[model samples]
Each structure stands twice: as C-alpha cells, then as structure tokens.
Target: MTLQAGTDTALAATDHGAASSNDYRTGTAARLAGLPVETLRVWERRYNISETARSARGQRLYSDAQVRRLSLIKQLVDEGHAVGSLARLEDEQLRTLLPAATPAAPAPARPVKVALIGDALVRRLAGGGRELFALDIVGACASLEAAGRLRTSGAEVLLIELAELSDAALAPIAALRAQLGAAAVVLYRFGASATLARLRADGCIVAHGPADLSQLVLLCESARPGAPQFADAASIALAPPRFDDASLAALASMPSDLICECPRHLAELLMMLNSFERYSGECANRTPADAVVHRDLGVAAGQARMLLEAALERLARAEGLALPVADGAA
Candidate 1:
C-alpha cells in the first residue's frame, strides 16, 4: 500500500540518501528581491516558473535554477508581463530567454520512525523495511504501553512491537484490548507464546511466525483478501465461560497494582498457583481475604473471598497466565 505523508512510510522515503546543506538556498533571493516567500510561490503557481525542491524536514527550498527563473519572472512582472501571458510561452523561447542557473542538489530524505522493538527477531521481521519503531526486551512492554495509550487517544498505528509481553504484564494488555476494541489487530505483532495464548483465549486466530507477518505485509500491499484477524477466545466459540460477569468485575477491581509494586508477592502467588493447578487442576481466580487462610476456594473459603479471587482468576485466564487459586479454579 502507498504510505501516506506524516506516516512511517514518508519518513522512510526521505532517509534514503543524504544531501549537503549548501545544495539549496532557503529564502535567499526572495529576501534579496524584497519579495515575500509567498510571492515566489505565486509565480511558480501562476507562471510555472520553476520546479521546487523539498528539504529533509519537508521545507520548500529554491534551487539556483528556480531563483533565476524567479528573477526572470520578476523582471517580466516589473515590465508589465502578466502571469497569464507567461504561461503561453514556448519552452524553447523560455529556455533561450532565461539565463542558465546551476540547479541545487535535492536534500537528503528524513529518517523514519517505525518504533520497532524486540530482539534480533523483530529486526528480522522488519526485513530492511524503513521507518520501524524499535524497542528491545523490557522496552517492548514500555512501547506497547505507550502505543496502547496513544491508540486510546486516537493516534494512528505508526509503530508496534509484540515481542515484549510477559506473564506479568496482563493488566496493560487488558487496557490495550479495551481501548483498541476491534481495530487492535491491524498494527499488532502476535509472535510470542503469551500473546498467542491470549489470542487463542480471546477466540482470535492469529497467524504464527515471522514468515506469517511478512506475508501479511505483502497481503496489505496487494489489497488482497484473507488478511488475518485475531480471534477473541472470550467469545462463545472458544473456551466457554469459566467465570461469570460478577467474577470478572471483581478481578478487574482488585488491587492488581501489587503485581508491579510487589514482585516478591507476585512470584509467591504464581508459584502457589502453579503447584495448586498441577496437583488439583483448580485454576486460581482470586486473592484470599486473609493471606493466612489457604482454603480450597471451590469447597471451602468464605463467600466474600471466593467472589474476589474468582475475578482475579478470570483476568489471568484471559491473559494466558496461570490462574490464581479461587473458588472457580478449584
């Protein structure tokens, strides 16, 4: 697909070659001729004076050829030749009449900002494509969060990296899902185990591997049908409901901040749930009311604790992480 200006495509196009600063003059003869820059533009528009060159930053610059052309046009205007008359001039006549002016070399293209992220894996995926937004390792999560926030604020998908998700970063994922809603898959890279599992849980079918992504880029470019869409596993077609609405609400409302602030607690919780699931096949869904009371939620815990823990488990299940021990998992 043809990339739009101000998009990553435009940025990449401008960065292809470097140009020297002295190649073109900015506001040179326009200042010397006591003419506003707009006047020069008017002559180009009205009289077809000269072809303009653009700078890396997208500024319009006048080449010496253009300056000489402008000078000729200005003199003609001073001598009372209306622009309408100038347009009808023969190319040979114009060339003969206008003095030779050395053309300035065009400026270098601008650098692209695709905002890529990940290990060698992400760069390989890019495959020499310009204007990638790059980030690596933990930075991938940070980029995802930033992209998620920007997408929520109506920003277009300029950069995306999906190699950074961990079992620990579910809340941010949830937030991104909630914001992107239907359009989320257009810019996302579904290449990790956690990402794949989450997509599966959501009932979304995402293509696997880097080759899949390269194919996707080609498909988009070709305007072909069958572009991949991530399935929402939460839908009825996927794993049916393990927890009801009230249970999910409770989980979302819990103090999940502890996941970020207290990594030690998170580690202990993950370990406990892993062991519990291994032995009992019970998924952990909630935080117990008292850390001291390790009750089998399905058969024992207080009703209040059961409800709370169930919610947390639902959130975890959606993200493909091990569920916490709660009434539902047990």
Candidate 2:
C-alpha cells in the first residue's frame, strides 16, 4: 500500500515481497531501465518512485521488481507521460495507462557474429543470450592484446565498451578492424558528446549510456556492411570562427588602448585552432571518406591560425611591441 523510493510498486505482488539483497545493483538497474544513474538518483530524490535497499557500504541495491518498475516508468515516459504524474500511480494503474508490451522482432536469418571488448557487456549479453537470439558472440576480450591471440573466431562485428574516447584507444580498434575485416564497429560509452564527432569520423557507431541491452542488440542488428555511416550535421558544422576582411581591418585598426590586448587573445585563438587542426588530421586519417571532411576542416584551421598570427604581428608592430614566438616555429 505504501510506495517507497527505490522499492518495487507494481511487480511487488508478483514477487510476493520486497527485493532481496542479491538483486540488481544501481548500475545494472540503470542499464535495465534505460536511464542514467544520475537520473535514477534524481527520481528517487524527487519522486520517491522506488525504495532501494542498502549494502554494508551503503551502495544502493535494487530488486528485480524495482528494476521492472523502473523499466515500466521509462516506457511510460517515452510514451509522453510526465514522471511527476506517474510517480503517484500504483502498478496496476500505470499498467492500465501503458499500451500492452509488444513482442520483440523475430531473430535475423543469419545470427550476427559479434566480438565484445568490454567484460561487463560480455557478461550481460552472455547471461542473456536467449533474449538476443539474433547475435552470436564469437569472442570476448578484455583488451586488444587478448584479441590479437584469439584464433578461429570469425567475428564480423566488433562491440567496444570504452570509458572515454581517445586516439590511443582507437588505434588498436583500427588495427582490430583491419585484421578481422570487421563489417561494423560499435562503440558504447557515456558522455560521448565531446568525442562523438571524432568517433563518427573514425567510422564508429556510437551508443551513449545508459542504453538498454535491447537497444544495444538493435545496434548490432542495424550495423551491417555498406550501411550508411553516422553523421551529426550540427556537430560537423562546429568549426573555427572565420573573420571577413572588414573584421580583420577593424582588428588591425583597433585603438592604441586595446591593441595591447590583441596578442594574448590571438595567441589563445591560435591554440584552439591548432588543437582543432590536430583533431581534424586524426579524423581524416581514419578512413578514406573521412579524408574529405576532416581535411577541409584541417585546412581551414591552419589558414585561420596563419591569418591570426599575421594579425597579431601587425598589432604588435602598431603598438611598438615585440612579436611573440609563433607556436611550432623557429
């Protein structure tokens, strides 16, 4: 009768009681509910949706019923129900409002040959293999070194779970793709916005967390040979600011009072442009098509840096100041 934060509301009747200590953890619950851990905490804090148990160390332990309730809430929210209104509804009442759960799509004719790089994801998928009949996990490796020694596994797809994106991490993945002739490489990570463009440029399919297993499975199904690559126009459109002739002239003719500030500002702008230049080069080298876009971006950044340096030199001359040494120049 009483609904508590982190406790199962609707599925409590089926389970006949509260969640046991050995049930789902906060991370597992977040994955199952298709919600981030931070979002889960906020829901508990604000709505008291489910009551969770605590471990000796005070870690939140979610029961199976609680996870199910959270999943239902996510589904309802996706269907346009506000969490504030649904927070007070009982399981039966919420179920009445929800459309009947649809059956999963039938498995593909040929099971996808998948190689997993993350241990946690491998365990989750291996444990629930029956639920994902469309995927045939051929290999699971903790690192690229292990993947290199794997013999007799013809995995067509690579599923990489990374904590963050970096050139170092991607180098090995590129080698793996070339070695295995992989048809697709999917990346799963949280807070991927910062590196999403670079990852896409490297021909990766990115899934930002906390994504559900079903969603991950769907990504595998969708990643196929000759499939259209991922593109985010807004992210790609982000480039260094370009100044017109008039703006350059205005900066060149700035008042003597403000001319002193020009060099420092130009130095900062040059640093940013150089950073983007490196990023574009990395992306361009990833694949052939990537060369087109990233090359253009790199060229633009390089030209901007040069022009800014020239402007800085002019400003210095106007103010009778010495020119700062340009970055990477003798």
Tens digits of per-residue lDDT, candidate 1, 94-193, equal: 5454435632223222121122222333335424332121110111222443444232222111223354345444555455555544212323334456
**Could you give candidate 2's per-residue lDDT for residues 1-330 as a string of tens digits?**
332322211221211111232355555566556777688888888998887887665666677667767877877888899998988988767778876674222221344567776555554555552235345565566655456654325667787776666656666777878888885555555444546656666666777744566777677767756445445333444334344333444544454555256655675676677778778878625455467767677776767777776786777687785543423443
The per-model lDDT (C-alpha) reads 0.39, 0.61
What local lDDT score does residue 139 receive in model 1, on the 0 to 100 scale? 15
* Top candidate, metric TM-score: 2
Question: 211, model 1: CA deviation in Å?
Answer: 4.6
Off by over 4 Å in 1: 1-53, 56-142, 145-170, 177-182, 185-197, 200-207, 211-216, 219-330
Give the TM-score of each candidate.
0.25, 0.36
